[model samples]
Target: MSLKGKVALVTGSSRGIGKVIALKLAEEGAKLVINYPVADEAESAQQVVEEIEDLGAEAIALQADVTAMEEVKGMVKEVKQEFDTIDILVNNAGITRDTLLLRMKEEDWDAVLDVNLKGAFNVTKAISRIMMKQRSGRIINISSVVGLMGNAGQSNYAASKAGLIGFTKSVAKELAPRGVTANAIAPGFIETAMTDQLSDKVVEQMLSVIPANSFGQPEDVADTALFLASEGAKYITGEVIRVDGGMTM
Candidate 1:
């Protein structure tokens, strides 16, 4: 899975699954661009960049709100200036506004979709323009198991992720001729700060459904992203690989 001389941009990579994915790519010899949203997250973003540097890979942290097209363009422009070209893009930034359909606020739905689905579109479109010229690139989107099998309190989240699956497939078809591959990774219950917010009862419910009897880790999803980004997956596109503990199956 050597990515020597490749340049990878992982959005929302300051922490959790995104951070781990960035590290995994760095370990594979890819120079990294860690993307976080807010100024307050600069410290953690720099920390991740330092960690990648420690691994003997070049890395820098950039901030951009994926929901905004201009900001996304600026981030990609900066990356092009620094790396010359992008070889890999991981759309790992997402947020949840969990609530039953009846109780879900309009803002919650919009926010989740903006960051999870529209954000991927914004970043992918911007990066694809660059990749089209390069004629070779990897786009790995981080989806979720709930998107496969709907959840009660996560209607908005599920919708956003389901949207990503469709978007991934479409991009794969559109970019494949140019040798740009796009795929989605749907993870079950990954042990991340996001999952930490679940109540004990909710956790128990999830565990009962998972055949693995244990939750997954961020590294698990990161490894999958690594595979999708590697040369080994050159022929794989428009596919969704699940990292859930057999929860959806």
Candidate 2:
């Protein structure tokens, strides 16, 4: 997985799984661009840049709301100026608005769909142009098992993620002739801050359905992203690789 000289852009990479993915790519010698949505997250994003620098790799922090096309385009411009080209793109910016269908508000539905689905659209549209011209690139979208099997009280989130899968496949086909491959990673119950807040009973219930009988770590998903971005996955495209401990199977 030696990615020396490769440039990777990871959205929503200030923290959580996205952050881990950014670090993992940097570890493999890829230059990184850490993206955060708002000013409030700038500190975290810069911290990620510092972490990458500490790993002896190059990185910079950029701010852009993925749902906004102009902002996404501006960010891509900056990335091109800094790195000249982008070899990898990770659409990991997503949000959840969990509520039952009957109680789900219009704003909640729109917000989730805009960030999870529309954001991927905005970023991919902007970065893929560079990849297409270069005749090579890797695109990885972070989806979820909920998008596959569905989950209670999360219709909007599930819909956004499922839509991402369709978008990924379409992008893959559209860009494959140009040597660009697009795929999605559907992660299961990964142990993050949100999972930490769950009650013992809730955690136990969640683990009961997993063949591993334990929660997955952020590294599990990051490792999968690393593989998808590497030359080893060059022949793979328009596929959904599950990092869920056999939960969907």
Candidate models: Cα lDDT each: 0.96, 0.94
Backbone clash total for model 2 is: 0
lDDT of 1 by residue, 180-212 (tens): 999999999999999999999999998999999
Top TM-score hit: 1
TM-score of each: 0.99, 0.98
Which residue ranges in model 1 land beyond 4 Å of their true spot? none
Cα deviation of 231, candidate 2, in Å: 0.8
Residue range 1-249, candidate 2, lDDT tens digits: 899999999999999999999999999999999999999999999999999999999999999999999999999999989989999999998887777999999999999999999999999999998999999999999999989988988999999999999999999999999999999999999998656765798778889999988889999999999999998999999999999899889
Clashing residue pairs in candidate 1 are none
